[model samples]
Target: MRPVLLLLLGAHLAYAGKHSLKYIFTAVSGDIDFPEFTSVGLLDDGQFDYFDSNTMKAVPKTEWIRQNEGADYWTRATQNLIGTHQTFKVSIQTVKERFNHSTGVHTWQLMYGCELDDDGSTRGYHQYGYDGSDFVSLDKSSLTWTAANPQAVITKHKWEATTYAVKEKAYLENTCIEWLKKYVDYGKDTLERKVSPQVSLLQKSSSSPVTCHATGFYPSGVKISWQKNRHDHDEDVDLGETLLNEDGTFQKTSTLGVRPEEWKNNQFSCVVEHQGKTIRKTADDIITNFESVPIGIIVGAVAAVILLLVIGVAGYLVYQRKKGFKPVSGSDDGSNSSAHT
Candidate 1:
């Protein structure tokens, strides 16, 4: 029941801290486009290191890690990940057999992390999931395993019998927190930096929903809301997931669905809040794309024009050959095909 509660209430298991270090490993079986295994290391929810079955090498995702860590660090990390990869392969099979799953897509996930609060409070967790449901989790206080279902009992007993939980607890409390502190020191400038998002109001047409997109912000936390006639409007609004950008920043979008007549008669605004800064965009800021030609159509038109020009030139050559007129041969003209000659 504890594990089941953890499964249902994820992201609320512990209070969010000022910083966190997490390692997420996923192993998959059956046919899928994704890699068979992947391991990601995150510092404060931003990826700092990554490894996969395809790469078979642990590599830094952030420049700070790249600059701070050397080849020896990567080599050790890679070796550890290789062992983890093999273990995950076997673990997935073991879990599959336990669940009586013979085929199809099955995933065995392990998420373990330590959080450090600004007030010096700390929390650590190690959890496992099978097929997107909780299998078991470590109860650090009692040094026991909490199984979500009967199928996980065997694993729980087997793991408890050995010194696995002891080793894991040690690592989570000591080594994990140590590495987290070192990483925070390494990327303190980037991690603690607060960059305001570039907000934009967009719509494809009058009938389409108005979207407030905020991009290029650090720390990832943001709030987007809609206001009608200067009052908070929550109806017919959709909030999208915050996503990481390639440049290590974050982006988020919130869409408001309202009729054109309603928006025209009433004042509508999108308000974005990030890092203690509030930005509000009114209807005047909405950028409509319906009047603009699509890039595909523009490219096709350009290609069509170029193709017609080429065809016309080729046809003229054919017509000229058909007539009595002929150009002199290259050999007769005393010119070689080689430009240098």
Candidate 2:
């Protein structure tokens, strides 16, 4: 399992033709048993660098990055992260005071990055959050900051009075985008590689919903749907978000809720599409982990699955804050204003 602290920081999803690079800095205050300060850098939603107050050193998370960057790069990144760590520590206290939070698990985070589309267009963003809520963000075009809450208004005015927005805009539009492109080139083979997903059909019991799970996929572009009698079926379907695996692959699940009688009366199947290939599985392929288990043990098994799903959802929520890029056909310009837990 990934460190809970890292999950609290961010796990960002990747977008399909467009590539992105993001930096996430987190500071915490209270009795929470976690690193007080930590920094993470992601390339196309895959972590490339990470640093925490405990190690006090910046390290690469990918072999390609470690091989391409030298000692000087790590040293410079470490120094910059150390400075940001201290700044975040102070910022956390400032936010606690502003929110009247005296002693609890409070977090202050800053996320900023740039996105490059395959067509050569780019977009940039800089956002801050306090205790899992939006604080403020920079509007590059206007050279101003937008405050999400009243408490952020003070910081907004403070930044607008100085040349902070100008500097940030310059970095996001130029330096950040340049770095993103360079990093993408460094790992072109890995980042651009395509891998098909392994599909599975699962069910806890006959009464439980059937889950279609797909794992070991790359580029994070996949579609899982249900079919009834060779036609598309959408009713009573629960689609899950694509999640990152520790090995740099992705996984997703979609559950179909239908009575056993209804499923028996019709030919139901799960279909997964990725990388120009399709895989289909029918009810006959369902894997029941609870088979032959006692009633009490079966209940426990169900509870365990639910718990895991809850934890996955928590991580998904954290990752959702750092917006990803999109393909050329996508209309979203990789801009999001709100930051939620």
Candidate 3:
């Protein structure tokens, strides 16, 4: 039974890397108001998962296809992905999808990756192309598509001997452009319906850097940053990529580092700027150790002591000022005070 289980597990792993799908839509100008993409993965159990590019969330397959008219066009395209000579089996298993609305002109280009596995191992392979276009016979191996590389020397015949071929070429290109217009209009019509994400801050330890996170937002344009001190200035902060949430919303994290070991003494903050809303977080928002209630209580007490110390220092500064005492900047104590995104 143990041997059988291990064999089953091994088989499962090999089958897991089988197939996936993806889509990307971009509007340079006058095509779509915004740009977005979608990715899909095939599961071993024959289930399909869909993800929105902006939110990085796993959307239900039904909802994705229902809203996007381009899906039907792409679906048919996916069914026909082929590469030149089929050397790359992984190409068919993967999808290189693009919907370009460049320079106010939209075009559709897609490729299906193909790959092969030998006892659960794979060698890198290439991809091929196909759509529902009537010109499939002209480029059966997707050789014509290879010219995507700017410097590629490969070129295919543009002029056909017969007038029927000329008409067909025009039709295929026109159809893609028409589809591009439809896709863009659909995006613009639904653009305003997206929701804004909620922003929050979290920390692993009291002294650790704070991570400002935003969740459940749409359209993926939220900017997160860290600022130091109480000034209206921006500071350098480590920014993470915007990712998709499972609910079709967007989320991202921006981490702000502490100043030496006196992070508490130095005022630090995180600001999430999204859709005209400026949400902020400070070191004061920490929840302390969460391992256990006893630990939490202990941490609270420690925090209280730290707070009292800060208050005492502030009071001393006020008293010193009243007595006309000023410390030289370069001659000050080892404590250096400063303040991000």
Ranked by TM-score from best down, the candidates are 2, 1, 3
User: Which regions in candidate 2 have their CA more than 4 angstroms from the true location?
Assistant: 1-17, 290-341
lDDT of 3 by residue, 201-233 (tens): 666776676677676666667877766676543
Worst 10-residue lDDT window, candidate 3: 332-341
Could you tell me which 10 consecutive residues in candidate 1 have the lowest summed lDDT? 328-337
The per-model lDDT (C-alpha) reads: 0.66, 0.67, 0.34
Question: For residues 1-341, could you state the per-residue lDDT of candidate 2 as single tens digits?
Answer: 01111011111223235777776667768886667876667777666777788889888878889889898888877776677667777777887888899986777767677776655566777777776567787787899988989998989988788777887676666566656656766788799788888777888887899999887788788999999999999999999867656566677889999999988899999999998999999988887774643443334335434422322222225545434411110001111211221
lDDT of 2 at 135: 77
Q: What's model 1's lDDT at 130?
A: 75
Prediction 1 global C-alpha lDDT: 0.66
Model 1, runs deviating above 4 Å: 1-17, 290-341
How do all the candidates rank in terms of lDDT, highest first? 2, 1, 3
Pick the lDDT winner: 2
Q: Write the per-residue lDDT of candidate 1 for residues 154-260, one digit (tens) a residue.
A: 87887778766776666666666666666777888788778898887889887788988787788878999999999999999998756555456777789999999
- CA lDDT of 330 in candidate 2? 7
